[model samples]
Target chain A: MMKILLLLISFPVFAQDFTGCGEYKFKGILKYDEKAPLKMSYLVREGTGSQMTFSLVNKSDVITLAPFIDKPSQFKAKIVKLMDGTKGELRTPMEIGLRFPDPMSASDTGIEKIKSVKCQ
Target chain B: MKATKPFVLPIFLLCLSFSVGHAAEGSKQFYFLGGGGEPEGETTIFDGEVKRVGSFINSSGWNSTVSFNGGHSKTEDLIKSKMGKAKNAGTFSEKNYNDLMNEIIQKLEKGELKSGDQLLISIDTHGAKRSAGKDAEKTHRVALAHSTATELNNLSGARTVDLDKLEKIINLAAEKNVKLGILDFSCYSGNLLNLHNDKVCLISASGPEQYSYATTAVSLGFFTFSYPITFGSKFFDNMKKGKSLEELFIDSRTTGDTPDFPMINTKEGLAINEMMYRFLTPYLNYNYSSTNNFSAGYVRRGDKFEEQVCRMESSHSDFLKLLKQMEEAAAVANESGREEFQNLREALEEYRKYQRGYEETLRQKFDVEKEIKDIFKKQFPNDQKAWEAYAPLDFLSLNLDSSITYYEGLAERDKGKKYFSGMWDSTVAQLKKQKEISEYVKANLSQNGLDKLKAQDEAFAKSGVTYKLSSRISAEAKKVYEALYNKNKSAESNPCRDFVL
Candidate 1:
């Protein structure tokens, strides 16, 4: 009886479920060297939607997106370069892929929402 | 032979039973490893102003100084005495440190320490970019610091361990089936919680980019001392009798000068103790509270309001009515008669601006949400779902900066959604009149307004929806109205405007 009571009382305090469900979209600047194999960026997405896309834009210059279409989600061409003339793509590890790709896209429309990009 | 056999069998059975029971119960182990040492002879400047400094200097001693007298004789004496004590203290030499760590690993592998057991490893050392060079090499452990998630799992030994040894060690004590909490007072301690786990609860003194300091006046660092002080003796006395981890952490942040100490836990909503929540809620209830301290409070208040006002579908017709009023006001301004027409036009323009501001606010919020999502994706490649539920509203409310007045209109139409309707509705109404919303957006978005607007446009295109407004307007009107409404709504919801109250 004592053991059961203790368990009951301690239940709410200890019980917790940490699982990521639903959908979310997030965004942040790529923090790593653009030329590096992997670039670090932050992103946020919310709601239940069939597609999500991430894009990067430089405050100043415009670069072409033709050379950077390999994995747009992982890496993308900067429309413009910083005043210093350093050119790089926003990229992270490609192994992870789109975290929550729309299941329907694969089965129905065959459209991949995430892609890679490079600047000419 | 018969007599001997009977006794031996009974003993064997009893021994087997004991071993099995022990195995079933699992192991309980807690590990803490952290220290900071700068071998290049660091300087400690003692100001003559504070007594606390005097005590610290006296207790720990300065570079070569023994006492405040600045006498060379005493300095040499103190150094010699301390050196002798240090040698005798048996701090980890290379051989010993490895041996101790290996022994812990061996125990874990042997299942001597089972799952649901506690393991706390704390490091109070300088973080280095690399595990080489002077200060970096002596204070750093390349294997411990750079160990991958797989490596941690291999050494953990138990079927259900409390701590997940991913890129960072997550404290599993607050979660179900485990009772453990780890405190790493180092600069990047918050990174530990970045690992994907809803079960674990983490409290970091500072974010990864920031540094954590321990003042001379306090025996422990700000976070370290605050935990014990706020939670009181109960934490130590029974562990179970103390406030929940969430409560203790909330109190610590609220009471200190800490910035928005990001708390990521799996437990849905504010899992803090009721008493603590009640206590902290009032401090945040005031309109003029500082943004740094009260942002978390607003989040909590918003969450509370959400609970009261259960999710409403598109059926609440009052939302349409309010939108119609605004639309009518716009139309009247477009085609009016006389002298007060200018005043009316200005008000309509203000209202239109408010709408645009609201949309912009949503777009900005989405940007923040996207940034957070990207951060999580980078951090937890394997467990994206853990970050998904972490803050549902952070993403849910991204494009949902609707006027409180609008929400109230919905509440009035549907009584069921009026749980704490009055509170939030009134606050929103006040904000609408005060131009707080517009000011907040201008202040925060001054640096990145254009980029944010473009992102909003892109978000709309990608989502296949041009505007987030009442479904009453035509698709084209909704798009235009959304842009206008967001601008004005942001003006009304500005924190500074609300703070004026």
Candidate 2:
């Protein structure tokens, strides 16, 4: 039992040393379409879990997180609707939140939630 | 019915004939043969004492060991394959050299060359002004004799061979109406640029006097580091545009820090030259293509891509042309009392803003991803989690209330572990304090005051501190306290979450 515990503790250290985890920086335009360009903001956090969120802002729209989680860190929250009903998604290690695009851009789109647990 | 069917058959036949002819016209055959030689030599300075300078010339000589050896084999293989069933030349001996030159002359005289027949030759060997004694002089003397500007010009039927032999070859290719290019991987290869002509293009390895050899592997020759293998695909694709030889060379050499390699066309009244120039200038003017478009003879380095793209755009005279047009239009509008100035200004401003915002969004995203990766390094020092998550993350919620809470929980979970505890505690404490300060300022400081305080605090906290308290209290207590403080402070007077949970 002691040996097993020691192995478990040492596993992360060994794994980290081998992993080439360093920052990668790049710059390129986010093209959604020919027109209707939305200024996009992205934040991705990974630790015990992984979470990704995108915030898109434009004239006449102010969007914030739509779904509230009891534990935001354990999961990710995606802002699905702004003042106008533009859609987006928030992804976490075990769950996913999706929002629908405006009817003008994409009609018949709906919000989707997917649940799965991933161990890193 | 029979007459109508006959007419339809003729129409179909005509269309088929046209399509087949088009396909044949579009097809191109490109052949490339490149060689580089950097002979290690000892130079003796005839000052009272003979100072013998040893073998190393430049980085190109030392770094190109692997590339040179590999390039030689590859070139030999390619040439042999092309010359299959023809007389095989055993080596680069005098007899073989004469045979090869004869073969080229025979091909030219036979009119076997077509408009799209591409011939690429690259030679990156040392050129000696004076012959050295015996052994060292033999191979190096070829540049002075058979490969000299005058010899090549005489062979190619050029009036004057003042330019480098490489330049003369390209000019001959033009006269023969064949697409020709040469990648010269030698020091002073750029000398060919002075002899630019419509039919010829030269891509040099480096600036004049700068050694163009390799430090890592056996240096192949000039243009070995930058040519056909690296940017061959793009070059072939560009050839389909029917660009002049000059245009093609300019575009090829515009990618790196080497001096602008010139492309020249001597043929007058040729539309191909102008077309090639117009098509290739846009690509060559920038160090990087806007679309990560790789060209023949070039590789993209990630660090320099964006800056190169920006520099290319800023250097373009087209933008200035547009500005001049705008100004003229504005002046006319003002004279006519149309007040279109506001409209024009607004339009340009809006366009500029949109471009700026688009670039900013990409920059921010890149920064965020980088930050997240960095944090992962901190959280899972030796773990692959950070690397794996690099491409997937949006922005790191460094300033988010939830982020604070999450880290707090992680700290609690890490209780009883003193390994890196000091580092973790200090980071958490500093972050907590920062949040507290931000909140305090938000409630009390004016915008200007807040900015000043931020600058001062950031300067003071840049290196950060590792708080080592000499107390019996568990490390978890300090972490828990910091987390709670930060969470509450970021929430802006909101009640703290139930810590017991």
Q: What DockQ, between 0 and 1, does each candidate earn? A: 0.04, 0.01
Per-residue accuracy of model 1 over A1-120 as CA lDDT, tens digit each: 011000000000011111122112222122222333221222211111112222333311011111112212221122221212112222222212122122111111111223223323
Candidate 2: DockQ?
Answer: 0.01
Q: lDDT values of the candidates?
A: 0.29, 0.30
Each prediction's TM-score against the native? 0.27, 0.26
TM-score of chain A of each: 0.17, 0.19
Residue B383 alpha-carbon offset, candidate 2, angstroms: 73
- Candidate 2 chain B lowest-lDDT run of ten: B44-53
Most TM-score-accurate candidate: 1
Q: Residues B1-501, candidate 2, lDDT per residue (tens digit)?
A: 446665898899999999997676521322222222211122100100000000111111111111111123444453344233323335333344444445554555566655555554434333211112232111111221122122110111111111133433455566876655554443334444445554454454432222232111123565222122212212322332334443443343323222122222223212222322232223221112111111211212224437864764564335434434644764765533223323323433433343344344444444443444454555445533222321223212225365456445545755666633333354355445435533432454345443443443343242121111101111221222222222223322110011000
Best by lDDT: 2
Task: Report how far off residue B285 is in candidate 2 (Å).
Answer: 21
Q: Candidate 2 versus the native: TM-score?
A: 0.26
Candidate 1: regions farther than 4 A off:
A1-120, B1-29, B37-105, B115-117, B126-178, B196-201, B207-213, B217-253, B260-501
* Tens-digit lDDT track of model 1 for B1-501: 446665898899999999997687433333323222211121111111112222322343221111111113332233334333222212223343355445545545554544555343333332211111222221112112111112111111111111224223232232223433444343333444445344444444433322333322122334312122211111121122223444444334322222112232323212321112222212211111111211112122222434422321121223334445555675776733222323323433333343344344454654554554564565446644323333422222222234343445544754554533443344344434323323333344434644665665454333312112111122222133223323233322221111110
Angstrom error at residue B314, model 2: 25
